[model samples]
Target chain A: DVKVTQSSRYLVKRTGEKVFLECVQDMDHENMFWYRQDPGLGLRLIYFSYDVKMKEKGDIPEGYSVSREKKERFSLILESASTNQTSMYLCATTAGPYNEQFFGPGTRLTVL
Target chain B: AQSVTQPDIHITVSEGASLELRCNYSYGATPYLFWYVQSPGQGLQLLLKYFSGDTLVQGIKGFEAEFKRSQSSFNLRKPSVHWSDAAEYFCASGYFGNEKLTFGTGTRLTIIP
Candidate 1:
């Protein structure tokens, strides 16, 4: 079975603070993704990485960035957090562009 | 651009009852269809996917979906509803490779004992 693990399950931060959400996968997948889930909006992609050091923006990437220094780890960074940035963040890894993804539990972020 | 639609916002069914969730898609050609379930704070789990071959596909957790090319629909069905079946279900569609999936608003399901 594939396992995707997130660094934090829940987090709270103040406005203008820096926030980092980490994800790691044991499956050696080449593709990793970050998405923010919201009510009525469903899951909207924030960023995705196809390989180490290669990143692509998705539906929404404002105020957020990602890092993929290692193949097994992907990190989501909020340069400066804001209240509007509060959301449930999810990370997933796949074998390739067109493959089933294994997702981490998720991190519920709260910005105040 | 490809898009997906899950018409029903919420569906309720008693335990042991049959279940069905409607999903519709809009794409130029045959799209890759997927169904996922989310439980509370957990991430989405792949229940099934439709790429090629047979129109009907079976998934984990006792779920099955049939793809209708004529209607551009992939509706999920279950023979019996379990209490653990209560969760948010999403329908998604995309092309082969490098294409991002567009998800529906999702349908919240409730199981009555």
Candidate 2:
């Protein structure tokens, strides 16, 4: 089974603070993705990394950046957290575009 | 652009009752369709997927879905509902070999005794 683990399950940060959400996959998948889930809006992609040091912006990538220094780890960074940035962050990894993605438990971020 | 739509926002069913969830997708060519269930505080789990071939697909936990090309729909169904089946279900669509998938808003399922 593919195991995807996130660094935190819940986090709280003050406005303008920097925040980082880390995700690691044991399967060494080549594709990693970051998504924010909101009520009535479903899961919206924030960023994705196809390979180490290669990143692409998703539909809603504003105020967010991603790092993929290694094949097993992917990190999502918020330049300066704002209240609007509060959301449930999900990380997923897949072997390829056509494969099913395995997801982490997700981190519920609260930016106050 | 590919998109998915789930008409029902929420549905309630008694235990042992039948269940069905509607899902529709808009895409130019043949698309990959998936049904995912997310339990409370858990990540999404793949219930089933529709790529090609057979229109009816069986999935885990007694769940199945049918793909109708004429209707552009992939609706999920279950013979009987269980308490554990209460969760949020999402329908997603994307082209084969595409990295991004368009997901529906999700339908929250509630099972009653």
Candidate 3:
């Protein structure tokens, strides 16, 4: 079975603070994604990495960035946390384009 | 662009009753369809997927989905509902080799006793 683990299940940060959400996959998937889920809005992609040091912006990439220094780890960074940035963040990984993605538990971020 | 749509936002069903969740898709060619379930405070889990061959596909947790090319629909169905079935269901679509999937807003299911 594939396992995806997030660094934190819940996090709280003050306004203008920097926030980092980490995700690691044991399957060594080539594609990693970051998404933020909100009520009635579904899951919106924030960023995705196809390979190490290669990143692509998704639909809602503003205020968010990503890093993929290694094959197993992907990190999401918030330059300046704000209340509007509070949402449930999810990380998913897939071995190939046609394969289904495996997801981590998710991190509920609260920016105050 | 490939996209998926779930018309119902919320659905309520009694335990042991039949359940169905609607999903539709728009794509240029044959698309990959998927149904995912997300429990409270949990990440999404793939319930089933429809790529090709059979139009009707069986999924885990006693769930199934049928793809209707004529209607551009891939609706999920379950014979009986359980209390543990309460969760948010999302419908998504993607291309053959596309890495990104277009997800529907999602339908939240509530199982009533």
Candidate 4:
């Protein structure tokens, strides 16, 4: 079974604070993704990494950045958090573009 | 632009009753389809996927979905509903060999006693 784990399940931060959400996968997948989920909006992609140091912006990449220094870990960074940035963050990894993606448990961020 | 639509936002069913959730997609090419379930406060879990060969696909937790090419629909079903099955279900679609997926608004399933 594939396992994807996140650094935190819930977090609270003040406005203008820098926040980091980490994800690690044990399956050695080559593709990693970050998404923010909201009611009515569903899951919107923020960024994705196809390989180490290679990143691509998804539909909603504003206010967010990503780091993939290693194959097993992917990090999402909010350079300066705002109240509007509060959301349920999800991380996923897949072996390839066409393969099934396994997701982490998610991090619910609250930017006050 | 390619998109996924899940018409019903919420559905209620009694325990032991049969279940079905509707999904439709608009894409130019033959699409890769998927059904995912998200438990409260958890990440999305893959229920099933439809690539090409089989229109009828079975998934975890006694769930199944069928793909209809003419209607551009991929509907999920279950023979019996359990209280544990209550969750938000999402329908997603992507082009072949593309990692990006467009998801529907999701259907929140409520199981009645």
What tens digits encode model 1's per-residue C-alpha lDDT throughout B1-113?
Answer: 77789999999999999999999999988888899999977899999999899999999999999999999999999999899999999998888775467889899999998
Write down the lDDT of every candidate, Cα atoms only.
Answer: 0.92, 0.93, 0.94, 0.93
Recovered fraction of real interface contacts per model? 0.50, 0.52, 0.60, 0.52
- For model 4, how does the per-residue alpha-carbon lDDT over A23-54 read when each residue is reduced to its tens digit? 99998889999999999888998999998999
DockQ of 3: 0.75
Return the TM-score for each candidate structure.
0.97, 0.98, 0.99, 0.97
Per-residue lDDT tens digits of candidate 1, residues A3-112?
Answer: 99999999999999999999999988888999999998888999999889999999999999999999999999999999999999999887555656677999999999
Per-prediction TM-score, chain B alone: 0.97, 0.98, 0.98, 0.98
RMSD of each: 1.1, 0.8, 0.7, 1.0
Tens digit per residue, CA lDDT, model 4, B1-113: 88999999899999999999999999978898999999999999999998889889999999999999999999999999999999999999988678778889899999999
A best-first ranking of the candidates according to their DockQ comes to: 3, 2, 4, 1
Which ranges in model 1 have alpha carbons more than 4 Å from their true place?
none
TM-score of chain A of 4: 0.97
Q: Tell me what TM-score chain B of candidate 4 gets against the true chain B.
A: 0.98
Q: What DockQ, on C-alphas, does every prediction get?
A: 0.62, 0.70, 0.75, 0.66
Pull out the clashing pairs in model 1.
none
